[model samples]
Target: MKSNQFKIVIDDTREILKWISHISKWFFPLILAKNIIQATLPYIHILFGYLILDGIIAKDSSSDIMKNLYWMIGLNLGLGLLHSFLTRLLNVKTEYIHHATKAEIARKAQTLDYEELEKKESLDLLRRAEEGINSNGGIPSFCNTIGSLITHAITIVYSILLLSGLFIAAPKENATVLERVFNSPLPTLLFFILFASALFLNFKISEQLNKRSYAFFEENVDTNRILNYFGGVSNNYNFGKDIRIYGMADMIQEEMNQKNDAIITMMRSLGITYGRYSALIEIVNQFVIFSVYIFVGIKAILGLVSIGSILKYVGALIRFIGAVSSITIFYTQLDLQRQYLNNYSLFLNLENKKYQGTLPIEKRDDNEYELEFRNVSFRYPNSPDTVLDRISFKLKVGNKMAIVGRNGAGKTTFIKLLCRLYDPTEGEILLNGINIKKYDYKEYLQIFSVVFQDFKLFSFDIGQNVAASIDVNEEKVWKALEQSGISERVKKMDRGIYTNIYQNEENGIEISGGEAQKIAISRALYRDAPIVILDEPTSALDPMAEYEIYARFDHMVSQKTSIYISHRMSSCRFCDHILVFDKGRIAQVGNHTTLMKDEKGLYHTLWTKQAKYYN
Candidate 1:
């Protein structure tokens, strides 16, 4: 194993030990006592059998001998019952501890960053965590196996001691023949070799099976995405009619079938591999057992050993083989668990490189704040071309700036930089003559309230979703709703603001796309920040509703710094400044009237093309 692999195994062992220490403090003494009682009972059974056999062989059927034998039998039976009860009690206690530890690990996983979880490498690690928990049914089972293996090893030692005592006591009898027969080291060594080979083969088979299982899991994840896409066709209000007219059900079903067939083929191949290895291991185990039985039977037929001595030797050998097998199996399981721990360790070590230096930003004393981009340039991580190239512009506080651009004109990328989602690749962005980098990230985000076209709505109450992370009052929530022109629709509902918005759960009420967008806008307004960004917020609404929403936007955000992005040319009429972006640079900048006068400008070409629809 590599050094890192060793470290991960060591960490996992420490985790296991921590759990063991906790359970031992409370239940260890009880477990140890129970195991001792269990181990003692097996010897008690052996003693009872020895006394009865001796009485029969000697023809001593006296009343005292018979009575003593009956008492021994009763005591042995009681001890057996006690052993069974304690085993069940230990199993239940171990299960409880396992579930508690799994819960703690799951909670720790949830605290990880959302972006880190979305990475491709992280997905496989997450899958391993799932499989590890499933394989052992939780952490406690892993620990319980170690404890039970230890207990069984102790039992094996006790059985060997009892057998040795029996051989010494029967030295003059034919029963002493078994002690001489097994005393040879050659037979014991052969048994160990065969069993070890079989165990190693079994481990190889199980590891291959686990690898195939994970491959199937990953393929199913892709299949689920396809299913979700098709399931939306019939219920999507915007696309349902188009789908019905096109009759796309057969096409989608065929695609889904192809994905399913691919998974089935991989599973069949795995099953074949597992079957071949399993059969070979089973045959080897059977051969080892047959050889042991043949050698012992020859001695008994030759009158070299008594029937009782032969029975005792066979029992001891079986118990020893069983203990060795259990240890081998546990080691294999430990190896598999270590593989999962390594994956989890990788996930926890995901890179989160922090920005080195901070840029200074002047605090605004007045309501107005000036923003500037000084030769700003930027590119996304792992991408070659710059999305914004040497772009420079200025916006006065409380000014409504309309940014218009054709598709792929770098309009959205420019806004993303202003929001500081990704820092500039080359140049700097300034707020009040200070680099925005100097301000705290969270504090900087608080300066603006934005609603993008692809905004997400969580499965929460309408009011809570809008006033995100803030203590919301009913009066303020309703006021924001009223300002966004969605209060009338909300007031008509029976549950009003408290109604859940997801349709999958009981009592959840689903709203229209336009209504969802309005709720998003209401959330942005509730923030009451100085800067507001609306990226095509009214795209899903009707023409009349869209115009009315923009009219309300102008009134409600009158004295705030507003940046509006839209394909609709008419929306730019109310803005004090309009910027037309071409490729990754600013092509033109002026008020609507001036831009309209320049026929060669990109904005003029776009407006002329749109004006044809009205004509």
Candidate 2:
């Protein structure tokens, strides 16, 4: 298990690298060339200043001095123009590549399976990916690091060349200046040690900060889960009234406040620690710079070297040190970014149990088909107890059956098995005497149109909501709306089919629960699927509205096989056959009239309890 998890992390990092490589292949060469030019230009400018100083100090006597002065002037002008153009080009190219990479990441995220995405661990990994790898500044920082590292490497090489040249140019008698500088050794060793210590401290501090940031992002997922649950409860009319009456609002507020305080406190402590380390690093950095300057200045004034040479050497050393420091920082950032990319890769690599086949069962229609469950049993992932146990049933094509069950009686789980949202753990589900696993998953999904108890309402126009896409016809949408009993209400609206139906935005209208259910039915009806499953479709509707919808539904799907699940005994009266479930077993199976007459039946008992309401 651990090894598999590690492989997933590796795969994610590889995917991130592939994205980086694609962007780099187009713009990296340009960025590299630009950095090379930029790095070399600074050295050229230093050399030009040295030449100009030499000419002025020598009273411009030699003819060579005049020629060198003109060369320096041309060099300065060309370098400035080249540097400016490259900088602008790189800036624009980086932005374009960054945007393209981010879009690819988002597209990949969207294509991931919904079931896998619902897992808490998967969500946490995705959060890390979004925050660490896909944030506004991350890709740009990555590209910049790559460019800076390459440029700094070239600058270090050039600095070494310049230093070597200085050593050879000095007269033999003046070699003592070089000896004193190199022999003392304490300053050079001290400077490097201090610089390395500061770099190490900065890297460690940044690592801690990244960890805290990741933790904060993970906490947000829990916070969002809590908020969504509260929002759902508060918006539910039945729950809302009681919640208010019991004064539970304060408890919800207190929970939210406590979570917010915890996050804020963690961030505050991280900030203080980061500040302290940064301050200490800076103080040490200043001392290192002061030591270098004091040693170099005394030698130049004692006539050991020319003032021009001192300026060139000091400037080159500073640039070299800066380049090395930047290179170190860039690699540290890369390591941090890679860590998050690994998390994303791990999420993307998880095995989706529902999609483990080459094809879903619904695709093959080689023979006259009947659906069968042979000794089927199932338990949810990571759960010990079975939700469905040793269940077996068969439904021939065109059979209209209703499943009746009390709460937690496994009626929904049976439907989910039929749809292959999950596979049976102990036995086979067969279509036309062949295992459903042999068929294509997508084609299998196409066979059934399911209206779940808790259906979604998209924040799109009515037409898009019903069709699940924008290409649906207005006429068909209106027909579906009417069939679902919402057309009259929709037609009265200002925009009819075109009106946005979410209250969160301007110019959008809020839809009632019953209206939302009608839209859901329309969506299912529009699919024109042969197998229709409705789970508590009338749960939110009044008797008249429910009767009206059932009438239209029966008319529109007269020839299609339908499965209606409801606790309301009156709703299933017209169903051709009813299968009542009790504690994960089939307690009774018969037509509604036959089941109502059976005195020992669970369905008969439920019917008696609910019949009083109608009477």
Candidate 3:
């Protein structure tokens, strides 16, 4: 087994390489060229300055100096224009990468198995990934991290080599203050070591500061989770009426203020800690710059180099010091960025258990299919209690089944297993006399059209919403809407079946509760799958609308095997079989007449209590 530390290390390494490949493929070569040109510009500027100075100081005609000055001005102007153009290209590249990377992550969330969404660990990883590079501190962004690393590293190395050549003495000269130190190779080496060491220390300290800044988000995830939930509730249109009538606005704001206080405290602490890194860097820069100036001044006094050379050496040394510091700091930032990448990579690698099957659900004229749950048991991830214990049942071809149960009696869990949203913890589910896992996960899903209690409607055209595709058949869409009893309302709209289902403009359609429920039913009908499951699809409708559906339930379901779940026991009279669930077990299974006769059974007791109001 791999250790936790080892696993984290591997995840970070893989993520870095993956991002590098993506960024480099688009802009690495161009960025490298830009860096190379930018790197040479400083040295060229220094050289031109020295040549102009030498010409001016040589006691020659002023024409020579004028020519050198003109050349220097031309070089500076050309370099400025080039830098501006390259900077714009860099912006365009980084922005494109940012958008593309975010879209890729969103796509991954959409494709992930539904079961993974329930896991806390998966959700936490997803949040950290969303916080993304550089949002909290120095975390690297995928689009620009590689380019930055390459540019900084190249600049530092080339500056070091260029600065080394300046150390070689010209000749012996008249005695001057501190001339011995400038001529001594050992002193120069000592100063170089001190400058490099101080710069490294600053970088090391900054990286830790950056890591702590981002750590606040992960540490307070639970608090932020509640903050986000209540915050969203305040903005939700569905909760607007409740917020006003119940006077919940002030209450939610107080809760948000409490969470905001925690965020403020964390940021304050991080800021105080980061202040120390800045102080240390400030001290290092002062010492390094002062030392370089004194050494260069001594060389000039000793007549080892001209006045022009002195200016060149001092300017180059100052810039060289900055380049070295920047490179070291860039590396430290990359290290911190890798941790965020590890979080993203772990989420991307989360287990996916779909589509292990080779077989397809066969096409049949009569849509003949059979399903059986063989001693199936299930418990949610990280839960100890079984949600559905040893559940066994069968739905033969063309047989309608009704599941009756109180809340938390495992009705939804049973449907989830049948649809393979999750697999049973023990035993198996079989379709067509074989284990259901042997069939293509998507193909198996195609066998059923389930209208869940919490169905959602999108703001799309009526036909696309019903058909689940943009390339929809208008004829079938109308036929399905007609069967669901919503055709008349849809036909009266300005665009008929092509009308938008939600308000966008003056003529856009806005549906009532019953109309929306019927549209949901239309969506199920348009799928035309082999099996139909309706989990209280008509709960939102009026009694008359509900009666209209019950009256045409046979025509709506047609020959397809149907499963209906409802609190109203009267609905069970329409089905061939009723399965009564109590305390995660099937307490009884029979027709309504047979179950109602047994006074001791859970269903009979429930039926008697509910039947009182109607009687």
Candidate 4:
């Protein structure tokens, strides 16, 4: 147990030092100065008081007393100013460190492999790390705990220095044997033993309290996640309509209440246990104080120490015990905070298993990126079933292809593989005769622009959302918006392309579903990559509207490769090539004219069924 505790202290201390060095080189120096000044402030005042009493007893000159008085006041005032200034600087640095830590976490999360983002283990790890930063004060808590440890340690040293005379002062020759024993160095050793015992008791109590508190934090992760989800739903205006129309308010409230009740019960139980431990610590503290008084009083009675010495020893001993107790408590709390930092470090260290090839993609002006899925297959992580099985296909430059099938026909999985969101579990994907994995992952992704079925737009301004960047080109954004058929609606807005998408701001306006889809399409268009993929892009639009958008997009990307995915059969008629998927394989591949002739084919069957609805 002792070894493990020491190991944790070493590891956590190293971690804190690393962050302090990385975040701000001056953070440690400033914190050290601030803690030193804070800890010495009270000691200085105590020492001055002791000096004043001693001076008066010794019949010091009135001028000398006044000088000492003036010096004390001057030093205290100056130290106070320095302490405040350092504290302010530390606070600013602390906030910067906090924000920097959060940004690092966010950056790591964004750079994670798409597959990892979907894995349950990775998701839980991310949540724990984020909760540590967002809710638990993260590195700031480490800073504060470190400060407490330093301040208390300095206080302990100063107190021991002031009280050293109490134990070291020689016994008078006329003193009785018992009084001599009490005044000898033996009494000092015994007092130290007593103080050590008191500290030990306090340490044990503090360890117990920290354990309970950390356990509560661990237990609350899932509870807080659920409660936050519900809380978000209640606050989100998007869910307002369903909640009111379906009378789900009671259900959500009931779920929230249950989680809240469980948390409250746990908190109350923790409070009770903590109260008992605190009482025990306080009892130990008082006992130490009483022993200090008795020891000092016996020395005073023996005429071995002056009246001023008794007061100084008593005061210093009290401060010493208080400092020792604080050190124990803060050490335990620092360890608790270390566990949270460990979680954060674990998340940052999660390896990206996906190969990020170092080879740069050759820049081409002809937009001649050829892609092929050669016997590619994949199954989701931890799933027994393959989502896409032996999916073989090839794409020529500027070829317009339509992928059609019912839901769960591996259509979206095919797109995901083509986009290299997940590498094939078997076989390989090739780009321009070279394995796609050989090309730089980021550069390879730039070959295509995809508008997925469940695309999302942030609450940024219209132009920003369309361009997916802050540095938007007004000409390109307006062009993309016009091509996606939302330019007129945007032009009518008070802020035009600068207007926010949702009610995230007072001037922001909620857009219709079709309008949002158009914006998503506009985002895809703004990229103007060699290949454009529309995956159920027009699902929210009517059949006529869907056909119109597809028709305009088809012309807009006539020179570039395009892949259209839709349930509406009318959209596929304009495509030069079509691929029909069923289960996890390509069931059919041909053009609209050739595939329509085979009435028994999946394409013919789906087209005929959907055609009846439109007719």
Candidate 5:
């Protein structure tokens, strides 16, 4: 990792620790205890092995040997049982931490400012953050780094202390390793040298193999993307129709095969090259083990060292090497997990561009809300041209306005600004004579109940979907459904108000497009805010159906301010006033009859064209 990346990783590590601590106060101590026990088990077993070997080799009495044998059996059985218990407890702890961290991530994503969430870069950041937190051992990119460090440090220190006895020459004399190698027939110094050289070479080879494998996977990520998207279309229910009707099976399969072949070739190249080095490392390890055993056996044969000494020395050497190796590998794994932690941290730490307002919108029983857009001009972030330029409008209680425009004419942009999804880049919006930004964001949002062109309905019970809450007002839900003209349809369902709107055969409930639209409209009605917006919610309905929806919607918005966006002139006729837009500018604004009579106006031109199309 680069310096900046490493900094991010460290920052993330601190944050992760904090989050884990917040979720479970005992989690860190628990992990540390478990790891300590795990690390000590091997040394304890090794000590028991030496005891057993010494008791037998010394030709001790039968009772002594039997006691040693019982100890060996008890050590192994007890350690195994202890390990199993710790593992189960750790798994539960990890699972609990993961759940808590995931919930935090979810809350962060949902509560992010609307404009930030809409930006592509922001969305990508959020996605990477989500992946980092959702990955294996992934709670805020969970890595047992601190625990591993503690465990390995203890193991290394203990193993080194044990091995210190063997490295010293016999007769307890001051010794250089060279003197020991000359004194011993086994060439002890050369054995050390060979082991050191083998370990160094093995480390290099292992590092290269890991690097190669990482590069291979990273290179193929985009290839997998193409394969998953187009290749797996058949598996995705949403794309099943295209696969069947467009005869896309063969094309998708062929593309998938080609992508897979490329990925497989990369995999093969990595395995072939890295496998040789891995095999070499294993061979070297085995050679070291074999040499150690032979030397120890020769020493025992010469009666230079007892059977117990042989077991102790060899076991200590094995433990030392393994601990050292684990320490080295632990650093690498820690770095990788740290990078993932970096992404998660970056996402959570992202600052909102727009500062949150502190002022509160005064509560009024009569719902006296006024929205005024004064010289508002907005261009999306990183865009050259303004989507809504120099737009100004005013709306008060008991007003219904229709916004008419062709595609890309800023009809939706106006709605977005009105709803404060994105603030105007150049001017302020006034709410009841004060800048909307001055009022509390949450309080301001409560004033409007909007159903956008691309509205979403939940796969929940009818009442829940309409009320946007599980604890629904049954009578209110039915009234809203009636206003949206979907009550009778819902009444016929198996569960009535509690019926699932979208589900499979188990639930056996699915609604048509028009029916879904009505449900969305019902959602707006249930909110019953002072300002209402229906941005082409009836687009899927026929002209007569659209008119009926408009008629019902007008009745529903009785005393509330309303904004209706539609391309169909028939829907515009239902509004008290119509605002015609062309290329982000308002071309005309008037009642329907006046606009239609003015033949030279943009509204007249659009109205004529739409009426002709409908006819």
Candidate 6:
């Protein structure tokens, strides 16, 4: 058990260092130099002060005293400047590490399997991980704590070295009993034992404090998430209308106040506990200081050590004991940081169950990619009911196909499976002849452009949105806009293709739902993949606007294999083939005329009902 825990600590330490180095390769080396300077400066001042005092008391030459003073002042100024420069540089690097960690977390989320991402467990884990990061101040705080620990250790070592002579020197033969006792090695041993005991007590206190802190964070993760949601929603423009209409402001305020009060109460309790421990620590520290003064003063009175030496020894002993206590506190802090980091570590280490195949997708100039679902069945993760059960169909190359179904008819599930968002629970989907999973995940996705029902457009400029990248081709973007019938609307804007979507920035435009749908369509057209699938992206548009999209879609799709999913039965009449889905199964497949001939068929029933409603 101990070995396992040791290995975990080693791994977490390595992980922390890995991120530090990854963010800035020179961080550790420069921070070490900075710490060394920080540790040495105080000792230099102590030693210099002792030398000058002794010189003055002993009637040494003025030239010798002035030279020593000059050296000390010059060294401090030079090293201090270097330390300041390094500190500023390391601060910027630390900020980079802090922000980059958030970006890395987002990147990890995007790359995770869609199935895994959908689970509540994943979201809860993410919340806990973020809490840990916030509590520990992320990697930056950990790095700083370790540097402080090193500095304290260095100071202690230096103190020990300087005071060794005081411990080993012999007392004068005519010394008093008390002076002899103080001069003996026993005082030295007693100081060591006292320092060790103080350190042990410090560790025990620090452990309790850190453990309480960890518990507070752990117990409040859910509450904090709720608080964050309420906080964000209050500021969200999207929720403004509902909030105002429902008069939710007072309710939200009440919840916020309650949560804030709870957190404050817990903090007050924690602070009280800290205060008590702090008082105890101070007492221990004062006792050590008293012991040091008596030991050093007795030697000074016996004329065995100079007044300057007494001052030096007392300062060294106090600093040495303080360093030991600080080291204990810092080590416990490292342990706390390690615990916090475990959440983020576990989150990052989550396995991607979906196989990422290495084989490159076959490229063809003719744009004739064929897809076949061979007895594919799927159920969402941890779901008992199957969404798509033993459904099999082949999409014709370069042909327009329409899938018409009622709500909960598995139309979207089929699209999701074809898009490889979730792998089939049984059988497999084939591209050309080989299983689709055999092709590289990213490479396979490149073959199709899909506009889902709930597609999102960012707050970027229209050109970048269409291109889906920073390097936008203005010509291609305009062409796509024209094809999608939103060019005229875009042309009217002052910035035209450069106009920003949504009111997220200065001079940004808030487009209508119809305009947003057109932009989404334009984005798909810009991709110009071999296969185009529109899963009711036109739902937000009016009847005429939706018709216009379908009307221009053929010219827009050109020679690509197009799959259109819609609820309007009349709109699908233009397609050569139609699929009718019912209860997670393909109940019928035929052209409109062919299916309309069968009066009792599901397609005929749907078409007749829709036609009657229009009439």
Best by TM-score: 4
List model 4 lDDT by residue over 1-615, tens digit each: 899987978886797678658878888878878888889888766887778778899999988878878878998999999999988887889889888888888898899998888899988888898887655577766777788789999898898789778777573667678876886678778877988898898888888888888899899999999999999999998999999999999999999999999999999999999889889888889988898888888878877788778778888888888999899999888888878777787898888998889889888898778888899889999999988889888889889999998899888888888888888999999988899888899998898899999999998999999888999999999999999999999999999999987888778999999999999999999998889999998889988888788889889999999999887787788788898988888899999999999999999999888886566
- What is the per-residue lDDT of model 2 for residues 183-270, given as tens digits with 9 covering 90 to 100? 3555456656776775676556655655665565556656655765677877866477777889998887787777778767877887
Residue 220 error, candidate 2, Å:
7.4
Q: lDDT tens string, model 3, 258-363?
A: 9889888987888888787778887888788898887778677777778887777787788778777776665555556666665665666777766569898888
Ranking by TM-score: 4, 6, 3, 5, 2, 1
For residues 443-560, what per-residue lDDT tens digits would candidate 5 score against the true structure? Answer: 8898889999999987788899899998999999999999899999998888998887665435847788899999999999999898999898888988778888888788878888
State TM-scores per candidate.
0.77, 0.82, 0.91, 0.97, 0.89, 0.94
TM-score of 4: 0.97
Residue 333 of model 4: what lDDT? 81
RMSD in Å for model 6: 2.3
Model 4 gets an lDDT of: 0.87
Instruction: Tell me how far the alpha carbon of residue 470 in candidate 3 is from the true structure, in angstroms, after superposition.
Output: 2.0
Error (Å) of candidate 1 at residue 346 is 2.7
Q: Lowest summed lDDT over 10 consecutive residues: which window, candidate 4?
A: 132-141
Model 4's C-alpha root-mean-square deviation from the true structure amounts to 1.7
Tens digits of per-residue lDDT for model 1 on 1-615? 556754765677666555456545555544666766755665565655655665666666677567767878787778778878877876887776556546645654665543345455566566555555554444445555555556667767865764453333323344444545544455556656776776676556655655665556555655655665667764665576666789876786788678768767876887787688667656766675676577567655655456665665556555655555555556555655555444444454555443424543445656568899999887765568877889998998889999999887888888788887667888888888878878866677788999986887877777788888536677888988999989999998877887777765568787888999999999999998889998888788875677778888888999899998888775677789998988888899998899999999899998887775433
Q: After best superposition, candidate 1 residue 210: deviation in angstroms? A: 4.8
Q: After superposition, how far is residue 523 of candidate 4 from its true place, in Å?
A: 1.5
Q: RMSD in angstroms, candidate 3?
A: 3.4
Q: Whole-model lDDT for model 2 versus the true structure? A: 0.73
**lDDT of prediction 5:** 0.77
Question: What overall lDDT goes with each candidate model?
Answer: 0.70, 0.73, 0.76, 0.87, 0.77, 0.86
Better structure of 2 and 5 per TM-score: 5
Error of 4 at 61 (Å): 0.6
- In candidate 6, stretches whose alpha carbon ends up further than 4 angstroms from where it belongs are 1-7, 594-615
Name the best candidate (by lDDT): 4
- TM-score, candidate number 5: 0.89
